[model samples]
Every structure is written in C-alpha cells, then in structure tokens.
Target chain A: MRWKCTVAYDGTQFEGWQSQPGGNTIQDFIEARLAVMFERRVVIHGSGRTDSGVHAREQVFHFDADWSHGPDKLIRALRTGYPDSIQVYKAEEVDEDFHARFSVVKKRYTYQFFEGFADPFETRYFWSTGNRRMDVERMNTAGKLLSGKNDFSAFTANPGEERDDDPVKDLSLLRAERIGPRVILAAEADGFLYRMVRSLAGCLFDVGIGKLEPEDVLRIRDSRERKNLVLTAPAEGLFLDRVWY
Target chain B: MRWKCTVAYDGTQFEGWQSQPGGNTIQDFIEARLAVMFERRVVIHGSGRTDSGVHAREQVFHFDADWSHGPDKLIRALRTGYPDSIQVYKAEEVDEDFHARFSVVKKRYTYQFFEGFADPFETRYFWSTGNRRMDVERMNTAGKLLSGKNDFSAFTANPGEERDDDPVKDLSLLRAERIGPRVILAAEADGFLYRMVRSLAGCLFDVGIGKLEPEDVLRIRDSRERKNLVLTAPAEGLFLDRVWY
Candidate 1:
C-alpha cells in the first residue's frame, strides 16, 4: 500500500531533500527511519526536491510498504524515529497510483521577507532583510504580469534544465502583498521550471527596488529569452506553501 | 567602561552559558569571538548562568574595555563574527561598576509547551508533551505560589553548585498563559538559584497533569527542601527571557 504524508521541516539543518554527493539529506534521514519502521527497504517520493535552507509548509510525500499498520501508528513510528527537525503533519493511505511528484496539479510557493533584524522567535522561519525598504505596490504590479500561462524561460536559473524543454506553464496566481514591512510574494503554477520561483522572486525584488518596471516583467515573459533573467534569490526565503492534487 | 549585550542562542548546541568540561559552551564560543574583536583576551559575565540545553532571550552580559570604538561598532563586530545559531541584539556602555551578574535587578524566564508532538518550527524552542493533556488553569494557580522572596532550594538542581550559600530569591511574577495549544509559563525574579526555573516548571507540569493540586505548590514552596519537588523539566522548554539592571 502507498501512503501520502503531509510534511513540514526546518530545511536549514539538512542538505536538502534529495540525496547529496557526500552529505546528509532530508530523504536520507527519513529513509533511515522508514527502513527501520517497515523492517524492509523503502523509497519515499516527495512533491518535489527543495534545496538546502529551503522550508516547506505542506509538502506531500508518498511511501510504500507491505506492513498493514494504520496511518496513526505509522505516523507515530515516523514521528518517534526521525529527528525533531523533520515532522510528518498528516498521514493517510492513498490510491496505489497516487504519486507525490507527478500527481500534483499545481504547487504554491511563498517567499517571505521581514523588515528589521528578525525576531528571536522568527529567525529560522523568515528572511531578515535587515533595513532594506521594499516597494510592495511595484512588486505586486510586476507579480500581476506573471499570472498566466507563459514560456517562463526568462524566469528560471538554467533554461537548459531537462524540464525546461517545456517551459510553458500555467501560472494560476502571482500575488505580492505587504503585511507591514514583511512582503510575502506567493505564486502557484501547474508546474515550475528549475529554480523558477527564485528567479521570478529576484525579478520582483528588482521591481521593488526600482531597478526594473512592472512592464519589464511582461517583456521578459514574452521574449522567452535566457539573457539577463537569471538572478536566483536566496533559498532561505522560499517556502513550499502547498501542493494541489 | 561597562557594556551589556543582548544574546540569542540555540541551547541544544551548547553546554549552557558557562564554560565547562564539554564539547561546546555558549560562553566559550562568545568569548572566542569577543577575543577576536578586541584583539586580546576578553571575557563576558552573564546575568544568569543556564544549564546545558537551556536558551536565553535578552541575556545581559558586560565586559570592560578601553577601546576608542563606540558600542554600535562593537555590536556589528559581534554580529558579524558569531555563527547563525547565536545572535547579539544590542550592545551598549554602562557605568563602571555595573556588573552583568551581580548588579542585575531582575530576570524573566519563559517555558514553552507544545501539544501532541513537537512542531518542526519549534524543535529547539518548545517542549512536547506527547498525548498528555495539560491544564493551564491548574498550572497558573500553582505558578502564583512562586511570588515574593523565598527559599527556593526545592526548585533548584545543582548539588555541586558553587553558589550553594545563596539559595533564596525574590520572584516578582509567575504567570501561565495559553497561546493556542501552547501553555507558556513566564516568570520574573530578582535572581534564580540553579535549576530553580526548571523545578518550578516541573511542579507546574505536575499540576497540569493532575498529579498535584495547585495548593501543593505553596506547601512545596514553604517546605524549603528539594526532597518533595517534582522532576526537573527538560531544558529545551526553558529560556532566560531577560535581565534587567
């Protein structure tokens, strides 16, 4: 049977979800525990691979095992076995064919920025911008230009990525809003190109800083060029908000 | 010249505030950075000495110096030099006789609890009680017994403490408030004996779990003996909130 687990993590402590060259990864750590829990070999598939220092709000993952344990018991086993930095929020059996990576309709991501030195309470969860003032209106307008299906080759770090062969993606929503000095730019799309969210965030940051106009985003979206459109924001500021099945 | 530096730390990674025979200590790490900044030997005296795996909020520390540099520059230097797990929020000059430990007038502490299981967001900052239901009102009523000057030998845990002769303290306030599923106990006092906060928190936990009545707190407080006290609460839930001069 295959099970779907909604997960959240403080990604700072791990070397990212994917197995690293020679370092510990989130998957490696969780698999170690799953291997013990199931008493057999197990492979877990996540919604997508998040980079190191990247956070997730409701990441989905699926794992298969022959054991007949209920969701609650399996969740308890997973919870007790893994380190505190990784948590399984919810667990449930899914259709055998349900794939966390491929079955997702869209993925929503939000980038967070808080003004002032981060609160001792929030340092791990937010990007502390120190004293950089951002123009929310400008950033939002630029975000509005990105709310449709388009070839987002310009808004990706490496346009030559294997997934970039099909750069046309349906961007369902792109909203940049301000809750005081904190700016949360959230975007959801049927699929994302490699580093698409960070690259788009960098463009919005340029707009917020008056370095680029809102219309420039439209030009970049239409051009489909891989020229001066490759600024990837820091991974710490990005969050995998949720994934729609 | 005198100085005070507000500190934040991940206590899980340190052997408390004092240097001891251990892998790492908060003071040792801090003093190493201070030595680098001053270009000589430098030591910091903390307002409160915490046990292993305990954290702080506005932890006051003072160091005498003869440098021409202002306090702002020193703050920047410390912030730049320290690791991400630790942070210096403020630095400033004070009177020559103003000592960090001896001259501190009051200190605030907070203990955090999470329901069911630990949230990854608060892995370092909160204590999880698994499935145990905690009664906030009972904890609050028990907390009231902690006010005023009293012998808190029962609430401490340092059998090899050097400050064994100084066991009495004046507690200004003790409060238990529920924020969401978390019941936070915030207490303030003129001074705390070693493990005092942890012991008091343990008693509150006992009250929360119905093992003891709220009235039992006064009995324990007036006992002036550590024999009947509850077990020491985990260090992760405890924090040195502030130190007032």
Candidate 2:
C-alpha cells in the first residue's frame, strides 16, 4: 500500500529536506525510521526540497509499505522515537497513482521579516531587517507587477545547475501583509524554480526599503536573465506553508 | 555607577540563570562579556534563578560599573559578540542603593499548556497535555482558592535544600486564560519559592482536568506541609514574564 504523510519540522538543525551523505537531513531521519519499521530499505519522496534552516508547516511525502495497521497507528509509530524537531502529524493510504511530487496542484510559501532586531525566540524563524521599516504598499505593488505566469529566470539561483523543470510557472498569488513589526510575504505558484521564492522575497524587501522600484522588478522579470541585482533571502525566513494535491 | 538591565533569553541551551562552574550559565556569559569590556571580573545579580529550559521575557538584573560611555554604547557593547539566544535589551544607570535581587516588589510568571500534542515550533516552549481538554473555569476557581497571602509549603520544591527566603508569599494574581489550543496560566507574587510557580501550575492543571477539586487545593495549602501530591511542571513552560520593583 502507498501511504501519504504530512509532516512539520523546525529545520534549524537540519541540513535540508534532501538526502545527503551526512545523514543529518530530514529525509535521512524519516527514511531511517521507515527502514526500521518496515525491516527493509524504503525510500520516501517529498513534494520538493527546502534549503537548510527553512521551516515547513505542512510538507507532504509518500512511500509504499506493506503494513496492515491503520493510519492512526502508522502516525503514532512514525512519530514515536523521532526527535521533537520533526513531527509526522497525518498519515493515510492513497491511490497508487497519486504521486507526492507530481500530483501537486500548487504550493504556498511564506517568508517572514522583522523590522528590528528580533527577540531571542524569534531569531530562529524570522529574518531581522535591522531597524529598516518595510513599506507594505510598495511591496504589494512590486508583487503585483511580478504576478501571473512568466519566465522567472531572474529569481532562480544557480542557473548553471541542471534541472528538468521549466522556468515559466503560474504565480497565482504574490502578496505582502504587515502585522505589527512583521512583514509576511505569501507566494503561491503551480511550481517554483530553485530559490525563486527567496529571490522574489529579497527583491520585494529591497523595493519596500526604497532600494529598488516596482518597475525594475518588472523589467528584470521580462528580461528572463539572472543577475547580481536579485538577492536570495536567508533560508531561516522561509516556510513551506502548504502543498495542494 | 550601578546599572539596571532588563534581559530576555531562550533558555533551551543554558544551564540556568545563575553562575556555575561549567561557565554555561547566562550569568557567566554576561559577566564574561563585561570582563572583556571592563578589564576586570564584574559580578552581576539577577532577580531570581530560572531552571534549565526555562525562558524569560523580561528578567531584571543589576551590576556596578565605572564606564563613561552612555547607555546606548553600553548596550551595544554588551550585545556585541554575545550569542543571539540571549539579549540584554535595556540598560540604565540607577542609584547605588537599588538592587536587582533585594529591591524587587513582585514578579510575574506565565506557564503555557497545549491541549494536544504540540507541533515542532511549540514543543520547546509549551507543555503538551495530550488528548486532555482543560477546564479554564475550574482552573480559575482553584487559582482563586490558592491566591493571596499564604504559607505555600505544598507548592515548594526541594524543601530540604537550604535557602534564605521565606515560604510565605502574597500571590496577587493567579488566573488561567485559554487562547485557542493554548492555555496560559499567569501567576504574580511578592516572591516565589523554588519551583513554586511550576508546582502551582501543575496543581491548577489537575484542577483544570477534574483530577483535583478546588477544595483539595485549599486543603493542601492550609496544611502548610510539603508532600508528593503537588507536581512540579516542566521548566520549559514557565517564563519569567516581568519583575516589578
């Protein structure tokens, strides 16, 4: 049977979501647990990769296992003995055709920013802007200009890296909202390129701080060229909020 | 000149608030920074000591220094090179007679509880009461019975340990408020005994879950004796929210 799982992780102590030789990534931990439970080598696939220090509220994954137990016991067994930093909150048997990676309709990511030095509890999750006040109105304007389907090569990191995914994606939503001292940028896309969300967030922050203009963002997006002008924001501020089926 | 400082810390990585031989305590870190600034060992006093894994939002401390630089520069000096987990946010010169420990009039602590299994982000800070629904009204009723001036020997931990402070304290506030899945228990007192706040929180939680009646709490308090009936809640849920002079 194929099982679908939804997991949340702190990500501060992880190398990233992808499996690596160090055996310290979230995938490594979950796969190790699955190996123990199934008494065989089992591989699980995630929706996508998140950089180190990037959190996730509801990251989806799937693996095939021949277990007769129900989903509740599966969830409990998966949650037991794992580090508190990661939690497998939901589990269910899905159709064999439902792929964790390819079945996605859209994905939502949120980036958090603090206007001043963040408090101790917030340092692990928010990017501190160091007393720079962000203009939400300008950020929204820039976000609107960059919305809809377009070639996002300007926002992709490591252009030389080989990948099969296309650069053009339907960016259904790009908006910024400020609550108290925090500015949260939410982005929804059918697919995202490498570090595209972080790059977009960095550019919007620059626009909000008067370093760049909304028109400049449009020009860069239309050019379909990667340049040094677009910065990739820190991974600590990014969170994978949702992955729609 | 004597300086009063208000600091905040995420205590997951520290031994506690007091100085210890391991040099891993919060005081050790602050004093080490002060030694770097002053070319001599400087002793600092905190309002109280928190256990390992206990957090603080606004813990007050005081020390004597002969620095000529203004408060802003002093704050910058103290903040520089210190770990991001601990922050000395406020510093001001005060009269020599003012003491961080002795001059305190009252202190406020907040203990947080989650009804179900806490998520990854909340595990470090909230106590998880798995599958238990808390009764906030009953908790408040029990809190009222436990409040006011009383000899709270039942709520003190390590009663055999030598200490200078008295066990009798005027508990000004003990209230439980639930916000969604979280229940916050706020307790204010002229002073708290060792683990008194945690003990109080535990007993109130028992009342909240209908395991103990409010009258039972009164009986425990009026006995003026220590027993195993009161449990000391975990340190991570307790936060030193404020210290009033």
How do all models score by TM-score?
Answer: 0.94, 0.97
Worst 10 residues of 1 chain B by lDDT: B157-166
State candidate 1's TM-score. Answer: 0.94
lDDT of 2: 0.92
Per-model root-mean-square deviation over C-alphas: 2.1, 1.6
Q: What is the alpha-carbon lDDT of model 1 when measured against the actual structure? A: 0.82
Q: Score the docking of each candidate (DockQ).
A: 0.56, 0.86
Instruction: Score chain A of each prediction against the true chain A by TM-score and list the results.
Output: 0.93, 0.98
Q: What share of the true interface contacts does each candidate keep?
A: 0.47, 0.93
Task: For residues B147-200, write the lDDT of model 2, one tens digit per residue.
Answer: 999998889878455887798999999999999999999999999999899999
Kindly give the number of clashing pairs for every candidate: 0, 0
Q: Chain B alone: TM-score in each candidate? A: 0.94, 0.98
- True-vs-predicted CA distance for residue B208, candidate 2, Å: 1.5
lDDT of 1 by residue, A113-147 (tens): 77666665577667777767778888888887788
The C-alpha lDDT values of all candidates are 0.82, 0.92
Measured by lDDT, the strongest candidate is 2
